[model samples]
Target: MDAASSLGIDKIGFASAEPFTELKDILLRHREKGFESGFEEPDIEKRVNPELSFESPKSIISIAVAYPSKLPNPPRSEPGAYRGIISRSSWGSDYHDVLRDRLAKLEAFIAERVPDARLMSMVDTGVLVDRAVAERAGIGWSGKNCAVITPEWGSWVYLGDMITNIPFTPDTSIMDQCGDCTICIDACPTGALVGPGQLNSSRCISFITQTKGYIDDEYKRKIGNRIYGCDTCQIVCPKNKGMNWTHQPELQPDPEKVKPLLIPLLTMTNKEFKEQYGRIAASWRGKKPIQRNAIIALGNFRDQSAVPILSELLLADPRPEIRATCAWALGRIGGEEASSALNNAQAKEQEPAVRQDIEKAITAVSQSASR
Candidate 1:
């Protein structure tokens, strides 16, 4: 325990590495309901059984490292110069790398003691369900929002786990403290939280923002100014109300990079995007999703100033998704310039999908003008 603290791991607990039989049933049901975000591991066995990660798994170690919730001196988003926000989960250096380094240190420490302690560590990308491991390890209780809420750090902690071939007494599981608390479910913008601890990830803004395609209009408008991820559920959770972790330097947010201006992101070259956002977790899907979300945000803002830039993208952008999203933004802005651009796109846009988008945008503008 002292060694983990020395290595800067916020919380650590152990649990029997028995196959998560209950979680397997739940996951299968979730798949049948089509609620998965497609980012999950397809093999349920790998996700539930630690033995799949390593032979002769005995116990699992779950760790949590809390991050900051509040963005100090956040950049203002006014009329013309609207900005987009990345969620706190994606704020600083990628949690995956940070947690992996901590896990590696812990693995080294364990090896020194046991000499034969076989270990495998995993962060978010690992096949194991991190929250499930955390629950079993007594790290925290799974909240109604599907976030593991710790009594000390609230739901602001990032989780990781290590599978080991050593017999360790398991920690007591934390009792669910979210009795009658539907705050997070009610606060979900897309109603992704269908029930307590049940998330329809397909409708989740966090998942939607990461998708590399044109989003449906309903979610696009709801996405508002969020570029990378959504924090509405966590932000509204009463348990997480006042929590703000800042001790970890690696998890601290760069205000400018996290809450960035929307205009500049639309035309960022791959090189520029890599230089600016390569280290952040949100950049995993590359710039296309973020840029596409930015266009939707500009449209949602209805900022007239963005019409020119959006118009150019509508006509000249190489990516069909970008051009199609630009069309939506232009129609949403709805003015002489925006309407003219959509009209021009209607003629020259060759892609069937893009053409449909332009026509819809033009019709939407016409409808708005009539109203």
Candidate 2:
């Protein structure tokens, strides 16, 4: 339960390790499955390294940490054409930190018994497909939303692995419970869930947050107000109903990050950005990607207050991506002040792309003012 609490998992689920006798057999079968055939081999080597030797790993243990919390909807938007927004994850600290710590503790406990055993741990590294291992360990099956869904904790959990040289007993595998239901795939806003189990990670908002560098206007306009990750499919999952997973007490955000206003995030210096978000998972993409997201969110908000911040960004920021985004946000605000600033900025801006963005802002602002 300590691990569950740390992971913000409402309830924890355990899967026994598979016996060493079966390890070689399973590994062989999974290797034969291969990627070229449109099937991903569940073998750790294929998942992590094409050349990993299976002879060394004696056993694999899988664990599930659940994170289920009902989100209280944000206050309603004021009148005008608008779009909806969603919270990243309602209950906890970033799952990566919470789960990794618990796995570290578990490794220590195992080391006490098997002194010379080698151990490895991973959480959402993408190299090892987590859901497959969880399913094999009987923790849960990969649900339609592509999340591991256990009967006890629903689908809001993180999966982790501990591969050790010491042998242990493995648990039975779980069966897929999704019976022809395509709600998760159908409900995706950007159609990222192209099929029942297929996800185009490139088109995912969660992926967008992690992707480095600037985003084009086409992608920016569609992201809405999501400044971090996206959770539309997870919320729509029928299995996620009423699972009050425990919240990670330690993952509380720096007040600045918990409720970040779009304006200040764009203006933050590398030093200020480090001071504010350095410890969090969101810092990986550095300040620019987040600033880009913030600009998009401000555009979606169409809040007049964002106009000055956008204006300041046009003149002061060094990144051309940010300047273009500032123009986009100003255009969305569409007021006399925003338009005049954009018009003036366009003349002085040297980058063709940025100048084009400024001209686009002038047109959108003029049109909005006319209406």
Candidate 3:
């Protein structure tokens, strides 16, 4: 504990490197139900068995680093000048890098004591299910929202794990404290939380926002101004109500970057996006998804001022997805500018999908005008 505390890891727990039998059953059922986001590791067996990752693993070390829940003095998302929100998890330096460094340090510390120690570390992108490791290792219990709810950090902690050959004493597991609380389930904007702790990632706003291609109209409507990820479920959780972690300087958020102006995001070049957002976790999908989400947010806001910009993108944007989303946005911000742009693009738009969207947008604009 002293070594972990010095290494900047807030919490650590040890669990026997046993196959996640129950979790495998749940995962198979989740896959059968099409609940996966398609971003998960394809090999379920490898993810459940730590032995597959490293030789003769005796225990898995789960680590958690707490982060702030609140965005202090956040920028206003007013009327025409609306802003898009990035999830709290995406704030500060890329956590993947931070967690990896911490894990490396922990591995070295363990090696000092156990000369023959063999270790393999993983962040969220690792083969192992981070939450399962954390749960078994006693870092925290899996909440109804699918987050590891720590006693000290609530659900506002990042998770990572290390599979090792050391036989460390396992910690006591924390039981679920959610009881009958269904607030997180009810707060999910896109009905992504299909059941307690069971997520339908296909309908999840967070997954939808990160999608590289065109977003479904249903999800686009619910995404609102969330440019990167959704936090509705976490925000409403009783465990996270007043919890705020600020000790780690590297994890502290930049207010402007996390809650950036929607309009400016649409115009950012690849280079500009990289320079501005390269350090953050949300930028992992690159600028396209964020730009696309910003476009959707503009439409959702119905900011008439954005009509000119969105109209330009609708008429001349190189990317079909961008053009299609602009068409969708223009529909909501409909006026002479938006309607004229959509109508003019109808004949010129070559992509069948985009053209169909333009037609739908035109109809939406016409209906709005009629009302």
Candidate 4:
């Protein structure tokens, strides 16, 4: 614990490296139901078995580093100047890098204590289910929203773990406190929270935002101003209320970068996107998804000021996804100019899918104008 605190880990707990049999069955069911986000490890056995990751693993060390939830003095988004939001998780420096560094330090500390200890550490990308480890290690109880709810930091902590050959004292699992609470499920705009503790990733706005191609029409409005990820579930969780940790300086968010102006994102070049969002975790999927979501957000805002830019994208953007999304946005922000842009795009669009989008957009704009 002393070593972990020195290494900047907010909390550390140990658990026996037992096979996660319960989790395996749950994951199999999750797959059968088509609820997975497709980012999970395909090999169920490999994910549940710690021995596969480390030779004769006896203990698992789960660490939690709390990140800031509240952005101090965040910039305001007004009528003509709307901004899109990245989730609180992606606001600061990339957490994968931050957690990995802390884990490396912890690994070194353990190595010094036991020179022959074999240790294998992993962050988010690792095959191990990080939350499962954290829960077993008594870092927190798994919440109804599918987040590990630590008492100190609520669900705002980043989780990572290390499997070791040493048999350390295990910690008791924390008691679940989310009984009878269904705020997260009710608050999900897309109905992604299928049930308490169960999520339908396909219907999730966060997952939809990360998708590279054109978003389905049904989910666009629900996505609102979220460009990268969604925080509705967490934000609504009672446990997370009044929880904001800003202890880590590197984890602090830059207000401008996190809550960026939506219209300007449409015009960003590849180089500009990299330079601006490179350090944030939201950049992992690249700029196309963010730009696509920005278009959707502008439409949701009905910001007529963005009509000009959306029109330009509709006419000039080479990517079919971008052009189609622009058409959809312009259709939502319906006006004579937006209607004209959609009509022009529909005439020139060669792609069957894009043409369909443009045609539908023209009809939508017409209907909105009628109302």
> What lDDT tens digits, residue by residue, belong to model 4 across residues 1-371?
78788899999999999999999998898899999998888898999999887789999999999999899999999999999999999978999999999999998888998999999999988999999999999999998788999998899999999999999999999999998988999999988888877889999888888989978999999889999889999999999999999889899999999999998898898899999999889999999999999999999999999999999989999999999999888888999999999988887889888888898899998898788
Q: Which pairs clash in model 4?
A: none
CA RMSD, predictions in order: 0.9, 5.6, 0.9, 0.9
lDDT for model 2, please.
0.68
- The model with the greater lDDT, 2 or 4, is 4
* TM-score for each model: 0.99, 0.81, 0.98, 0.98
In order, candidate lDDTs are: 0.93, 0.68, 0.92, 0.92
Candidate numbers, best lDDT first, in rank order: 1, 4, 3, 2
Q: Which candidate gets the maximum lDDT versus the true structure?
A: 1
Clashing pairs in 1: none
Model 1 off-target regions past 4 Å?
A: none
**How do the residues 39-146 of candidate 1 rate in per-residue lDDT, one tens digit apiece?**
888999999988887899999999999999999899999988899999999999999999999999999989999998999898888999999999999999999999
lDDT of model 1 at position 249: 94
Span of 10 residues, lowest total lDDT, candidate 1: 1-10
lDDT per residue as tens, model 3, 1-371: 78798999999999999899999999999999999988888999998998888988999999999888799899998988899999999999999988998999998998898898888899998899999999999999998888899988899999999998888898889988999999999989978899999999989888888889898898887888899988888899888878999999999999999999999888899899999999999999999999999999999999988988888888888999999999999998889889899999997999999999999999999999999
Which stretches in model 2 have alpha-carbon errors above 4 Å? 1-55, 71-92, 251-256
- TM-score of structure candidate 2: 0.81
